[model samples]
Target: MAFAVSGYEGGKTVDFRRLAHTGIRLVGITRSYRDGVLSFEEGLAKNVADGDQAYFDVLREADAYIEENGLPFPPEPGAWELLPDPDCLTNPILSLDLAAAGITTIIWATGFKFDFGWLKVNAFDEKGDPFHKRGISAESGIYFLGLPNLVNRASSFIYGVWHDAKYIADHIVLQEGYMSYAKP
Candidate 1:
């Protein structure tokens, strides 16, 4: 959604792909369309979470049928501008005069947060993302194999999960590391 709103422009760590419906400013073609869409959704989740912006990316795109009827999702918050300083309150903009400021509108991006309350391990960070290296989370022998890019872009796909599962099984056959963490 951010990418779409940015008209495919990138940020410090972000990269954009052009949308045909949006405009012709930029275009990103990928070898696999499905993968690209999946990656976009994943990046959307991450970016919204990282920015601590209101997450209504569920409105990233309206269903064709729905759009035809005209549903107004609250407009997305501003193209959230990050300040040079980390203290968000210090630089709050108390007022803006549209004519004097040459501004058109204000959109407030409400941030999103993930909940890991059901997980058995103490692995999530302050932001609720599990701490991981490769596919391995902080909890010994526990793997977040189902997450996107646990080790690579394909990590959460069927093939990737199968490959990772096989590797885990092989390791279990040769060593008892996973068993050590398994309840006896």
Candidate 2:
């Protein structure tokens, strides 16, 4: 998804392989849609393959984040402790699970599932739909255009992206210094 946007805006073709190089990982999760929503859990328990060391080398870029991010280096083998918060707890399983999963970032290319639960904003209304003023969001680089009555009633339709795409693409071009979002 990022590659697609970057390519369209940059006027240069990019590949998904860049995802791994950029400290992002992907896993396809099994899911079913019902009533215009997608639902899945990380605990669904499926086989997610791990990448080679070459791919994981991208994580070294985050090494400086160990102390600042509070994700310290892995404890010595067979060493384990759990801290409870305010009592702060450290479960080695958390890191071990991530390492075993080989997933630094998982991008699900599912469309229109309207599942932004991972977003850290209170962008939802009482009914859980995006509470944006029109399609704009308070969160940086985030916007919601295709939802019922988002901008206008038609903003959720196929034509919505046509209108909003230009805005988003223009923003991407400016922010990322890409050429254009025009389709070749």
Candidate 3:
């Protein structure tokens, strides 16, 4: 009875219809947005331009259903009203609180980029920007899936993530030489 939907305007709007047609009752939907600046439509447009047609279609459908049924966009009660703190430091704690309040899981579909500025580790490229070599981050357990130049010029694309993911998986299993390894 559980149905997963991404947070985006066009694709989610479309996917919701398919779910409704399949007789799956809409219990809830999670909103994945950074800083609440980009709307669902904006996210979908970015995905479409990036050639993520599959994701774009899925989100378009789901959002349509929500609008048709007069259901709230996020579907989760109080989600829209909750404004994140300006400092952004409250995010993790707020997420934990939400989980304790009955949210079983969080689907974070947001795109990625370097956020290492906050970390004390001096992990960056020659230009002082965070460098993701082979999708491995300087921080342990933190890996970058889609980043340009990881394998090739277009390694940030979806197909490239698969190849990069393999290397990450292998490194995790064979942690002897991996820099991310640490003593328990």
The numbered model that scores best in lDDT is 3
- Which clashing pairs does model 1 show? 53-110, 53-111, 54-109, 54-110, 54-111, 77-107, 77-108, 77-109, 78-107
Q: If candidate 1 were superposed on the true structure by all CA atoms, what would the RMSD be?
A: 18.1
Highest TM-score, which number? 1
Model 1: per-residue lDDT, tens digit, 66-175? 57778765443443443233221223233334456454563435334446788868787777788876555657666666665566434665756776666666755655
Q: Candidate 3: minimum summed lDDT over ten consecutive residues — where?
A: 86-95
Off by over 4 Å in 2: 1-114, 172-184
- What is the full ranking by lDDT, best candidate first? 3, 2, 1
Distance from true position, residue 140, model 2, in Å?
1.1
lDDT tens readout by residue for model 2, 1-184? 1112223555432333344345443333444445433334342112221222322333344454665788858733221211121101111121224344554664656455567777778677776667665566666567776666454434566755567656666666686654444535
lDDT, model 1, position 179:
64
RMSD of 2: 19.6
TM-score of each: 0.34, 0.29, 0.30
Q: Candidate 3: how many backbone clashes?
A: 23
Per-residue lDDT tens digits for candidate 3, residues 94-183, read: 222443346556466534546656756645777657666777767776666666657753466664578888889998777755555565
